[model samples]
Target chain A: MIKKRFILNFPPDSGDKPFSYHLVKDYDIRINILKAEVYPGKRGSLLLELQGKKDNIEKGVEYLNKQNIICESLDKRIHFKEEKCIDCGNCTAVCFAGSLTMNRDSWKLEFDKEKCVVCELCIPACPLHLFEIDFR
Target chain B: MQKTKTYEEINLKLKSGKAVILTAEEVAKMALECSPEDILEKVDVVTTATFGAMCSSGAIINFGHASPPIRMEKIRLNGVPCYEGLAAVDSYIGATACDPDNPSYGGAHVIQDLLEGKDVLLEAWGKGTDCYPRKHIRTKINISTINEFTLFNPRNAYQNYNVAVNSTKKMIHTYMGTLLPNLRNATYSTSGELSPLLNDPGFRTIGLGTRIFLGGTQGFVVWPGTQFNTSKPKNEYGIPVSNSATIAVMGNLKEMSPEYLQAAYYDKYGVSLFVGIGIPIPILDVEMARRVSVNNSQIETSVLDYGTEGTPKLGQVTYSELQSGTIKIGGQKIRTAPVSSLSKARKIAGELKKWLQNGDFEITKPVQMFPKNTSLKSLKETEADND
Candidate 1:
C-alpha cells in the first residue's frame, strides 16, 4: 500500500464526470480531499491525498488523464528561497503541518515538502517573502 | 565594589590577543555548570546579538552637491520619497517608505542596493534660489559617490517585545507577521538570552557612546531610543516583561554589508529592515556575569491579542515554551514562531566574538548612562476649532 498527494485540475466542461466515484469504487482507493475549489463555469481544482495499492494509484492517474483531468504530484509545490531566507523562522510559525522547522542545533530553517498541506499561510507570513507556492 | 576585570585591563588583554570571548549562548550554558567566579575567570567578554525587523530605522545621506545646485525641497530615491527637510542634497530615507508603484520594494532595499555599490536613481525637485538656481535635477548615486552615509536608527535592539496573537474571527496582518484567526498561531520577535538588552537588563554597559556591531560594522549608541520605556513590570530575572529599553544607534552605512542588513516585506503590513546588531559585555564583576547567564526559560513576555481594538493581554509565555514550537494559551495548544532570526543572531554573535578575539574590536565604556527612570507617553487627541 502507498499514500500519495496530487492536485487534480478539472477541465471546465468535465466537472460532471464522477472522478472521485470511479477512483474509489473501481480502483478501491481512499480519497481524502485536502482542498477543493469549484467554479460554476470556470476550471476547478482539487488537492487530494490518495491511499491505495501502488498499481491502483497508477491506474487511477490513467483514469484521470482519460477524463481530461490534469493530475500532478504535490511534491515541489512549495518553493523556499534559501539564499533570500534569513533563517528567521517566521514561516515555521504559521506552518501547521510542521513541514517547516528550525534545526535546533544549527539554528537553520529546514523544509520537508512531503509534510506540507499547501495551506499557503507561510507565503504571506514570511517577512522576507522567501516562501512561494508554485501551483502550476 | 572590587572588580574582577576593568575596562583598561580588558583592553590590554584584547590588544595582546589574550582575551577570552564567548557568545551569550555559550556563556549561558557555562553559567549553568560553572560558578560565577569561574565564568569571570574564564571569560573576558560575552557577546550578545539580535537580528529582527526594526521598523524605526533609516539612513541619513548627503549626496554631493550637483554642478548647478539648488535648495532641494523635495526628493525621491528609487521612486521612494525621502525626508527633504534637511540641507540641500541631504535627506533621510526611511526604511518603511516605499514606492507608490511598488509597495514591496522600499527605502531599505535602496540602502542595500547602495551598500552593494549599485547605482540608484536619485531625483530631486528644488526651489529655485538666487545662489542655487537648478529647479530639477536627476542623477544616480552609489555609496562611493555619496559624501556621507550614516545608518541612523532612532529605535532598535528592543530589550523585549510582545507575542502577537489573533483571537478574533478574522486573520490580522501586522508587523509581528500574519496572525491566524481564533488563536491558531502566535508570533514573536526577540533573541531572548542572546539579546543585547536582555543580557544587560539594567543598561549598565550599553549606553551612549558604547561601541557595537551594527550591520557587520562598528557603530555607537547615540541615545536612548525613542519610546524607551523603563516603568514596565519586570520578571524575577529582572528582564522586562514587555517592549522596553531600546537604543538609537549610528554607524557608517558605507561600511555595512548586505549580508548583515536586509529588506523585509510583510503581506499587507508593508516594509521593514532586518538589522543585525551585536553588543559585547565586559565581565567586570560576578553580578554582570550572572545577568548574562539568564536563559530562555527565565525570560518571559506577554502574549497580547492583536485582533482587538487595543492589544488586550492574553497571558504570558517564556521563550523556552515559545521556541518549543507550541504553547498552551487559554487551554488550547497553539503553534508558535519567531519573526526574528536566531540563526542570524548566532552568526552575528560569532562574528563579533571573532572580532574581539582577533583584537580588532575593543569594547568601550559608555560616555554617559541611560536614565533609570523614564516614562512612555501616548499622543492625546484634541479638537480643533477655527480661530
Candidate 2:
C-alpha cells in the first residue's frame, strides 16, 4: 500500500462539495483528514493523508482536480531550521507521529517528513520556535 | 599502595600532550569491560558535559564611559532592560529579561547577537548629578567596543532534574516543555551519565576556581550555585535522585562562541539561555573511576505531575528508560522526551577532550572546596516560631 499527503485548496464556490466522501467512494482510496477549513461560499483548504494502491491514490488526486480543487503535495510543508535548533528533543514529546525524533546513534534531532502528518505539533513544541509552516 | 593522581600531575601530562583523556560516556562504557583500577591507570581525565536551558544566567557588561561620563542609573540593551544599580557603566543583563514589545527577544538573545559580532542599540538614562553631568545617551555597541563581557551564571549544569508530565485534561506549557494532557508523555533535561556533577557526586574534584569549558572557551567555577543543595538523599549509586548540587560559573563572554551559547523561547513561558558547560574530572583514585563509570540505567529521577499546583511526585524512572523513548507509569506506557541536547553534550565533551589532548587546556587545583553539607532552605512569608 502507498501513502500520500496533500493540501487541497478548494475554490470559493466549491467549498460545499464533499471531497472526502467522493474520493473514498469513487477512487477506493482511504482518507485521513489531518486538517480542514471548509465553509460554503468561501475559499477553503484541507491538509489530508491518503492511502491505498498507488493507482487509486493518483486517481483520487485526479478526482480532486476535476472538482476545481487545486491539490498540492505536502512534501516540504514544514521547515526544520537546523541552524536555529539546539537539537533539544522537546518537540518529539508532542509529535506523536514519530516525525521528530533523536537519532539514537548520533543523539541529534532528526526530522522524517515522510512520517510527519503536518500535525503542526512541533511548531509550539520547539523551545527555539524553529519550525515553520511552508504552504507555498 | 593505591594508585592516585593530582592536578599538578594531570597538568604536567596535559602540557606535554600525553594526558590520556576519555569522555564520560566512553569511560562509563569502558568500566563495563575493565576493572576500576585498570581504567583509572589508563585514563587521566574524564570530560563531562551538558547543554540545556539555564535560566539563572546573565552577562555583565561594562559599556565604557560616555562622552561626558554619566553615572548611568538605567540601562537597556536592544530595548531589553538590564539591572542598573552597579557602577556607572557596568550593568547585568539577565537571560530572562524580555523586551517590552516582544517577549521572544531577550537579554540572552542580545548576548548571543553581540557574540556574533552584531551591533546592539544601547540606551541609558542618568539622574543629573554634580560628579556626573550627562543625562541620556543612546549608541550602537558590539563585543569589541565593550570593556568587559563576562558570562556569570548563578546556576548551570544541574546534577539531576525531575521528569515533568501533565496529569490534567488540558495541555500545559512549562519550562520543562509542552506537556500533553493525561500524562501522555514525560520530558527531562539532563545528559545522564555525561553530566559534570553526576561524575563527581562527592564534590571531590569540581570546586571553586576549577577550570572548565564554558561556551566553547575556558572558564572557572566561581562558587557554589544559588540552590547548592548537596544534602539531598543519594541513591544506591551515591548519585542524587533529584535536583541536587549546582555550580556557579563565569567566563569571558567575548571569548565565547555562539555554538555554545543560545537563546531559547518557550510557548507560554519566557526567554532562557541554553549554556554549554563541560568539566574534566581527573582520575584521582580507583573510587573516582567507579563514580565516573555510572551509566544511565543506574541514574534515577522522579516524574512529577505538572498539572497540579504543588507538583506532586508520581513515580521514578532511569535515564536509560527515558532515552529508550518510552516509559511505564502505573502500567500505562508513556512516551519520553528530553529538553537537553545529548548530541550537543557529546560534542562539548569531545571538544573538551580535544582541548586536553592538544595541550590547549590544563587542570586547575580548586582554590577552595565546597562544603559537603548544604541545606536547601525554604522561604516563608512569616518568621518561624522559635519557642
Every model's DockQ? 0.73, 0.84
Candidate 2: segments with Cα more than 4 A from true spot: A18-28, A52-67, A134-136, B383-387
lDDT for each residue of candidate 1 in B161-236, tens digit (9 for 90 to 100): 9999999999889998888899998998998889999999998888899999999999999999999998899999
lDDT of each: 0.90, 0.90
The most accurate candidate by DockQ is 2
Cα lDDT for residue B284, candidate 1: 91
TM-score (second chain) of model 2: 0.97
Clashing pairs in 1: none
Against the true structure, candidate 2 reaches a TM-score of 0.95
